[model samples]
Structures are given as structure tokens and as C-alpha cells.
Target: MRTSAREVAVTAELNLSQVRALEVLLEEGHFGRAAQRLHVTPSAMTQSINRLERDLGVRLVNRTRHPVVATPAGQRFMHQAVRALEASRAAVEAARGVGAGLLTIGFIDGYSQAESRLLDRFHSENPDVRAEYRQLHWEDQVAALVDGAVDVSFARPPHSGVDTRLLDTRVVTVEPRVAVLAQHSALAQRESLTLDEIDELEVVTSATAPAEWTRWWVIDPRPSGQAVRYGPAVSTIHEAVASVRTAADSGSGHVLITGESVGQRASNAGVVFVPLVDAEPCRIELCTRRSDHRPAVQMLRALADAACSARAKTGRSVQRGAEPGVGVK
Candidate 1:
């Protein structure tokens, strides 16, 4: 008797990683590339495919080709794998009650002060609700929120070239942008500089970041319409700083643009921050998916708004020499 595709039983239990590997391999069409995407070695990717094929008792990939091709059975299995992964993610969200029990928050590196304050307020109001933080890279900020990897994120704005119709944002703080350069660099001696002065210097950027996002961060086109020079493309904040330091050490000028808070927190020995007198201020916002209307998210958003308002009021009060309020309302 012939068994249907759904009726076929596997000899071994397949894990989510294996399913994800198969999906990525098919999408990338190359073992090495797939391995890189999944942060695994090429040999590990090969072994995973071998195990998957062994368990399923069918050849899933045609390995003879330069760019791999999925076999007939593999193509059919791929469809199911996609659905299976989706179901698995849904099950996890369901188990967590989608922010009812746990609220996973994502934040970019060097921008944790505001997140910590917000979490403090959230915890005070929500004693029983569990919350955790995840550090996100510049390129993955918006994607993390959209993919449900985090319930919410504290990140910079202009998610450029990304579809954010399903996302919502609230401006938490608008801080000035600063230029980061090597401590030994000539520019570090200057107290402040304008964008035009740094326009000629190469700017460190992310390799995988959206073009518009990178442009905004680097302020690509100046008021004079000259294009900003691009330097080494880095994947992380540390790499960017290292590139700048290396260039500085070699007597070559390189710069990185980041928020004032991040610049002030630079603990790296060779890095120094200088205020950008003419640059646009960085807008740090609380980003959340529009589809997620859970109470936990709403509470966090309200607290963010209240905190921002209180800070603004306090700043004005201090400027006017008046006493500020005691706690967040």
C-alpha cells in the first residue's frame, strides 16, 4: 500500500535547528553560504543535511551541482518545513502568553541606560511579570521586532528600506549626535566639529545595514550636496571602533557617528568622542509591532511616554532654576 506524504513517519525526531538549516540551505542554494547565515561551519551544515536525509529516508538535496538544488521530495518537504517552523514559533509565543507572562525587550548596544530606567519602572508596576533584555545589532533592530523575536525594542529611527507598516514607535529621547574618532587622531583635539569638516573623512558603516539607514546615520549628502566618504564596513559596534582605531594608528582618518550617550560611554582606550555641532540629533524610540496589543506592551509604552515627559519637564525646570518633581507620575 502506498502512504501519503503526511502519513510518512520519520525514523528520528527532527529538531528546530535541523528544520531551519534545511530551509536556509534551500533558500541560499549553497552549503557554505547557508552555514554562514546560520552561524555554523560548512562541515556542520553538511552533517545536518546528511542527518535530515537519513532520518527522512530520502535525498533532500542534489549535491553534485555547483549551486545545490532541492530534490523532488525535498521541494515538497520544504513547504512543510516552512509551516512547521511557523507553527513552532507560534507555539512558543502561545506558551509565553505573548507578553502576558514574559516580555522580551531588545536594545542596541551602548544604549542600555534608557532601557534600564524603563525596565525599572515596568518592574515596579509589574512585580510578577518577567522581563529580559536582548542586545540587537544595527541591521537586525527592526527585523527583530517584526519577526516576534522580541516583544519590543529601544532603537534609533528611520528603519529605512524596511516595511514598518506593521510596527509602531514612540520617541523616547532625542539626543545629539557625536563623532567618534581615535584618541590620538588630530580631530580628537578639537572640542567640536561641523559636518562639513568631517565630510571628507571616511565613515565606518555596517555591511548589511540598509542603504538609507546607513546614509542617515552618516548623513550621506551634506547641505552642500557633497557625498560622504565610506570607510570599512563593520558588522558590530566593536568592529566599527576597531576599524577607526586601526585607521587612526595608520595615520589615516576614519570616523563613526553615534548618539551622544554612546559616545560618552566609550570605554575603549583609543576611542574619543567629539560633539557634532551641525549634525541632526539621534532620535531614540521605543519600537513595537502594531499587531501586538498586549497589556504588557501597552504598559511599557505608557511608562516610556511618562518618563520622557518627566525628563523634559525636569530639564525645563532646571533651566528655569525651579525644583523638579520627585518620581515618575
Candidate 2:
């Protein structure tokens, strides 16, 4: 009789740990060491090894041998056991890559604090899903998404490896650019500063950051036609802040041009954040993988859209982020 796929009944699973113990025992050539390999008591190993042989209805090991050599039947079973473990590992790894109930989000420097409301909403809608956030450089965010490390990201767009083709965005808010300087600097007294004043100071920028991103963040294109002078190269926002403090104390006058919101989070007592009222707007985009069609992605997008819409009715600039600058940390 021919059996359909639906008619085939699968039996309860074999214990993989016991099978692994058997394999390790065969490889190690000792009972005490095999027990140590599996982190089990020697008695437990004896029980499991016995149970495994009994389950198969065959004598696996030659108990008379002091070294415990495998019987011919056990030797034959060893090959199949190896294949079984490989198949089990392959299935598990493939399933993990699918990202079923896991929702991963990447954010640039300060955006994590901005997206809390949306996250709260997302958790409310899908309480069973595990939500994780990775804080990344402006350049690394998109690459993280394309590599499947993250399902969505809150970051600036047009990244090198992951451009419009690899990602889609939902605009949460747009913010003005700001110049960060030492509080003691003469320019810090002013409520607002223009790009020309920023151009006069040596620009402190990141060495490890992507060129295009650094150019944009530091206002590479100047109001004055003179070539911009690059000051020091830093690796992180914390490092940038440290440099700003150093320059402030020394009166060397180093400046960092960054988004208004990021300036707030990264600013300290020594750093004064002054709005560059005329600089181009910094768009805070909700970036998600274009090919992903998971429930968590859809739910997050919906929550962001609702949040943006509600904020629009109030005629407010995105404060902090879409809501507030301090991150969950």
C-alpha cells in the first residue's frame, strides 16, 4: 500500500544528548572521561549508555573489555548517529535564521531614546515577540540590516552597501543641525550659529566612520567656498565629547557639527549645543529591510506611523527624538 505524506506517522524523538555521549565515549576511549566530556556523573553516563543500547535492542559496547570497545553493531550505528546529529544541527540553524518571533532593531548613536514610545506600542501589540536593539555607527546600521543582524533600524539613510534597494524607510521626524562647541568659547554665548562660524573652527570628526556620513555630519560643504579644515579623528561619540572638553579647556576651539538631537545626548557641561538654524534638516528615518515581511516589522511600522501622525497634529519639532535623547541604557 502507498502511503501519502499525511498518513506517515513520525515517532517520538531519540535523545540527542545520549547519542552525543556515545559518540564522545567512542572518540575518548574511556567511561570516566566520557562522563567528564558530557558534564554528567559517571553513573548517569552508564545509565544513558545502557538505555541507548537497550532502546536499540542491541549490545553496543563489549563490557568484558577493560577499555570498553564498541561491538560490531555499535560501530555500524556510529556512522548513522553522526549523520543524525549533523541533520539536527542543520535544521536548528536554518530555523534560527528565519527570525520568527525575534524582532531586531539597530539605531544610530542617540535614536534609541527617540523610539521608546513606538517600542512600547510594539510590545503591547506583540507581547510574545522578543525585541532587541543594537546601537551602531551611522554607516554600520544598514549593513547590519542587510546581513540579517537586524530586522529594522532607526538611522540616517543611503548607506554604502545597503541603499534604497536594500531598505525602505518611514520618516519619524526631521530635525535641524547643530554645532557643538566648548561652553567657554565666545560663539557658545550666541543662541544660534551659522555654517560659516562652524567652518572657522577645526572640525573634530570620526576616523573609523564612513566618509560620506562624516562629510554630511560635519557639514563638509561650507557656506564659505574655502576648503574645510579637519581637526582630530575620533572613534566614538564619547571620544568626540572628550576632545571637545580638551579643546574647551585649552581654548583651541574645536567644533563638531552634528544633528540637533545627537548633540543633546552627547553634550556635557563643557559642550554647548547651538542650533545651525540654516543647515539642511536631518531626517530621522525608521529603516527596515525591504525583503522582510514578518509580523513584528509590520507592527513596528504601524506604530511609528501612528506616532508620527499624532505628533504632526501638535505642530511640534521632534523633541528628544520622536518623543525624547536619553536611550534605554
Candidate 3:
């Protein structure tokens, strides 16, 4: 059997023709189309694949029917081969152009759902672009952008040094992230609950104190001394919500905190929201990368702006509906 080094040498010796043939075979799933893509006859494509299999001593293609399939091992190897080839091509393009490398984007966790949808729309418009997203803590999100670990980020302001543009900014009401407790909880029936009512109940926050405080104070103003006491701190919104629900269902807890948007998200979850009369601030803005100007980044920024405008128009429509003299026929 060949040693790993020998196998590496053999793979290295496999020509671009063989790689292209395999790539097209994997993509088109038919030998005829693979041959057409490579501008070679079907027999030539077959010879190339046969040569590759002979060199690797592995069956790369399952030649069963009109359409072809790769064995499990073949699929794994083909995936790596395609990625390597794409990276190699990108390297060549980067050498020719000043700004053509992959754009690594970072975002705060809770904000990803909205930003990700925008990114999807952007990708559909610009199919040739390559990008990545990492969910990062708010503080670390900005630092990642600064350190060049990430090319772009969706963040809230106080971000400096890089060129900055506003992405999607939303006005959110801060209320007691009230726990929808068991029917037996003493505070459950209060028509309007104040922060003081649940002061003794266990609470939860999506992130650390500093991050949560930044968002709460900047986005939703609350009295400095009126912050809720957390019981078990969690790193994600889902985790926090789940913790609250579990605690409530088990009759072990009576309090939690979340954003105003939770109503739309948790309609069937049996949770009730109580606005904290003391909760003050009501809006937050998301900012995008400022410094590195890549085409994909610009596309993302534009998508964000569009999403923000759409959200604003939606808010206006709702407000108009609520106005006394305005009615939709």
C-alpha cells in the first residue's frame, strides 16, 4: 500500500484536466454533461477518470446508470478537491486584482436572524461572491473587525477606525422580560407589572452584564439601579427563552427578560409580556463595516439599508392605522 506522502504526491501529480472532469462529474451528475463542460468527448472524460482512479487506487465514480453518483469516500474526496481548486483559482485572481479575497463577516448573535436573511438576498444578486458569517459576542464583534480577523461586521455603534455605515436600526421597547409563570405564581395576574414586583424572582439575560447593560441602556433606557437580577446567565437568546419556559413550566421560577419582538416569535409558547413602567430607552441601530470596501460588502450594506427602509415603512403603515382619522377601506 502507498504511504500518505506517496498518496499526496500522486494527488499533486493529477492534472487540472482530471480535477475539472471530476468536478463537473460531481456537479452535473451526468457523464455527458461533464464531457461537454470540459470540451472533451465522453471517451476522453472516461479515460481521465479512469486515470485518476488508477492513480488514487480508489473508485471515484459510481458508473451505475444514465446519471452518475460518487461513493461516500469519493464524495468526501471530491468536496476537498473542489474546494482546493476554488481556493487556488481565488489565489490567482487575488494576485491579479487588489481586492478579491474572501470576505469574513461577523455579527452579534441575536442580530444574525435578520442580517442572515439580508445576506441571502445579497447572495442571490451577486452569485460570484464569497463570504462567511460568524456569530460573535458584541464586544468581540467590534474587536474582530478591528484586528482584521473579519473583513466586515454587523454591529451597533461606538465602533471606530473603520469606515462605518448604518445597517438595520430598530426601535425596541424595553419591558420586564416577564416570565410567563405557572398559573399559581403570585405575580402572574397583575394587569401591569413593575420591575419592583419581580425583583425577588430569578431572572436571565442573553449575555454578560456589560454587553446586556450596553444594549439595555443604549437601546432601552432603564433606571441605573433598576436592572433585574439574573438567576442563570446564558449566552444565546434561545437558551434564555428556553430556560425561562422550562423554569415556568416546572413551577420553579417566575421571571425572565427578552426583547419586544418575542411576541411575534413566541405566540404559541404560552408566555406573557409585561412592560416595565421604569424601562425607558426604546430603539437600537446596527452598523456595518466601514473600512474595507469590497463589492460584496457594498452589496450587503445596500441590502441592510433596504431592509431598514422596509421596516420603517412597515412601522409607518402601522402607525397610520392606529391614527384616529385614518382607516383602510
- Order the candidate numbers by lDDT, best to worst: 1, 2, 3
Off by over 4 Å in 1: 1-95, 311-329
- The CA lDDT of each predicted structure is 0.74, 0.69, 0.53
Ranking by TM-score: 1, 2, 3
Instruction: Note the residue pairs that clash in candidate 2.
Output: 320-324
Winner by lDDT: 1
Q: What is the C-alpha local distance difference test score of candidate 3?
A: 0.53
RMSD of each: 9.4, 15.6, 17.7
TM-scores of all predicted structures: 0.67, 0.64, 0.47
Compared with the true structure, what per-residue lDDT tens digits does model 1 show for residues 1-329?
Answer: 97655544443234667877887676567899778767899999999989888677899999897768889999888766765666666566767774577888897775647666887888998898887789887767876775578988887767642345556777666677888888888788999999888877899988887566787788867765777788888888778888888898788999999888776665488988899898877667788876566687888888877767776777721121111111000
What residue runs in model 2 are displaced by over 4 Å at the alpha carbon? Answer: 1-94, 97-99, 311-329
**Residue-level error in angstroms, candidate 1, position 56:** 31
Name the regions of candidate 3 deviating beyond 4 angstroms.
Answer: 1-101, 108-116, 156-197, 206-227, 245-254, 260-286, 314-329
**Local error of candidate 1 at 68, Å?**
24
